[model samples]
Target: MKEYKRFLLYGLVVGTVIGFYLIFNLKSFVSYENIFIDKTDFMLSSRLIIYNKTCGLQHWKEKKNFGHRDDIPFFSILSTILSSTEKKIIIIEFGANVGQFSERVLSIPHKIPYIVHSIEPVLTLFHLLRNRSRTFKKEKNDKHFHYNLAISDQSGEKPIYSPSQYGEGSTLGKAFLSNFKEIENVTVTTLPEFIKKYHIKTPISFIKIDVEGFEPEVIRGMNLSINAKIFPLFSFETGETWLDDRSVLAKEYTLKSFVEMLNYFQYDSYFIGNPYLLPISGTYWKNSFDGLRRNPNVLAILRHSQPWKNLKKLLNRIPFTSC
Candidate 1:
C-alpha cells in the first residue's frame, strides 16, 4: 500500500511539473495581449473591447483595445494615395461580423471627417452591431451607416446559419445552405445596387470585405474602373476552402485568387504576411490547426498607375511612392 501511495505521489509531482512547463513555454500563444505587449511599446485605450467570454474563464478571454495611434499607419498610408482636393472619404465594409473592426476605426483620433458604411447580413450579428454602434459615444461629424444585407453577385434572399457564439461559430456564415434547409429565403444585395441606393459620390477611399466564401462574387459585381478613380485600397479575408455548401466553387478561394482578381483590375498588391509560409500553402502544416482555421485575412492596396504625378509638388516631401 505504501509503495502504491509513493507511486501516486510521484505521478502527481510529474504532472504538476509538466503543466508548469507548458504554461511557461506556451504563454505567448495564450493571448494576443501577451504577444503584442512583449513585442511593442504601443498602448491602446478604447471602450469597445472584444471579450471572448463565450467560455467562462477570465484569463482565456482575448481582448483588443483600440486607440488613436492605432490609426496612424492606416491613415498615413491612405492619405498618401488620396489627393487633398478629395473632400469626403467614404469607407465601405461588407460582412462586418459584429462591428469589432468598425469600432476600432471609429476610435481613431481626428477621424470624424470620414463617413463609414457597414453591411452585415446575419440577423443576430446585425442587431449586436447596431446596438453597439448606437450606444457608442462619438463626435457628431462622424457618420455611420449600417445595412443588414449580404452583398453577392446576384440580388435575392437566401438562408444563412446564425450559430451560437460557442458552437462552431467559425462555420456560421458558410453553412448557410445546409443549416437553413427549411428556410429557403434570405435577403441579399449586389454592390452596384447598394452604391446607387446610398447615393455614393465619386472619390471613394477604402473598401474592406470579409464575406465568407463569396468574395469572388463581390469583386465581380463592382466596377473596377469606377473604384480606381475613387477607392485606393481593398482589404479582405481569403480562404483556401469554402465551408461545405452548395455554392462551393472548384478553385479553393485563396490569396492567389485575391492577387489574380486585383491583377484583373490592374492593381499591384502585396501581402501583409508571407503567404508561402502560411498554413494553406502547406509550408507550416504542423501548425496549421493553430493557424487561421477560418479564412486568413489580408490587406490589399490599390494605387493609381502614376499616383506620384497626381500628388502636389510640396507633398513630394512625404514618402508617398511605395507601399
Candidate 2:
C-alpha cells in the first residue's frame, strides 16, 4: 500500500511539472499573434479589439450579418486568382466607409499574402477604420493600411456630409441630406501625391472608390497613376442620376464623360450582376438616372490586361445566388 501511494505522488508531481512547462513555454509553438475575428480562424490569447460591426450588413428583422453580398465572394476569388499571376497583390479601396468592405476582403484566407489599403475621408469613419485595421494584425507581407484623407484632383479641404456615423450617402453636397451630419474642412490630397507620400511604388492589382458622385475628381486625380499602369482594375459606386455632382467641381463630369474617360484609358466598364460582370454599352446612360441604369457597382478593367483576361475565366467560380 505504501509503495502504491508513493507511485501516485510521483505521477502527480510529474503531471504538475508538465503543466507548468506548458504554461510557460506554450506560446513558443502556439501562436498568440493578434488577428481579427474571422469566421473560421482567429487567435484569441491577446488582441486589443475585434471590428465586428456589420456596417449595416445585418438584414432587416434577420439576425445574421450576411456580409457585403456581391463583394466578398467576387473579390475573394479575384484576390485568389490574381495572387497566382501577380507578385504583390495590392488592392486600394477609396471611400472604404468604416472598413466594412475591407473587412470582407481581409478576413478571407488567401493563397498568398495580399495587401489592402483602405481610404476613408470622413474623420470619424477613418478612426473606426484605423481601429479595425489594428486588430487585423499584419501577417508577413499581408496587411491592412488605412488613410484618413480624401483623394481629389488637388490638395485642399472639403466639407464632407453623411446621414449618420455609419456613412451612407456621404457627399460633398448637402443637397441630398435629410438630417445629415456635416464635417467642415476635411483635408484632401491628389491620388498620385498620396501614393508618392506613402512611397507605394508597387503596381496595384485592383482599386475601388465610393466617393458619392465624386468620380470626376477622383478619375482626374488618378489619371497619372492610371497612365502609369499602377492599377489594372477598379470599381466605383455611382449616383442616382448621370449628373448629380453639379455642385462638386469647377467642371462636373457626366456619366457620358465618365464613360469617355474609360475608353480613353482603354478600360471597359461592366456592371456587377452577382456572379456575372455584364458589359455596359456606351448608350447605357440614356436608359435611366441610376448609373448603368439600375446597376450601381461599376467595374472598369484595363482592356485585354491579364486581370481582365483572368476575370473572364473566374466568373463561374463565384456563387450566382449568394447576394
Compare the candidates by TM-score and give the number of the best one.
2
**lDDT for model 2:** 0.61
Candidate 2 residue lDDT tens string, 77-125:
5564452225566778888877877877777766567678888887778
Tens-digit lDDT track for model 1 on 102-208? 77666665543667788887666777888888865555577788887878777877655533442222222443344432322357777778888889765556677
User: RMSD to native for every prediction?
Assistant: 18.3, 16.9
Q: What TM-score fits each model?
A: 0.57, 0.67
Model 1: colliding residue pairs: 157-186, 158-186
Off-target runs (Cα >4 Å) in candidate 2 are 1-69, 81-86, 137-140, 165-168, 175-181, 224-228, 241-243, 246-257, 282-295, 315-323
Worst 10 residues of 1 by lDDT: 275-284
Q: Which stretches of candidate 1 lie over 4 Å from their true place?
A: 1-86, 165-185, 225-227, 240-254, 273-294, 305-323
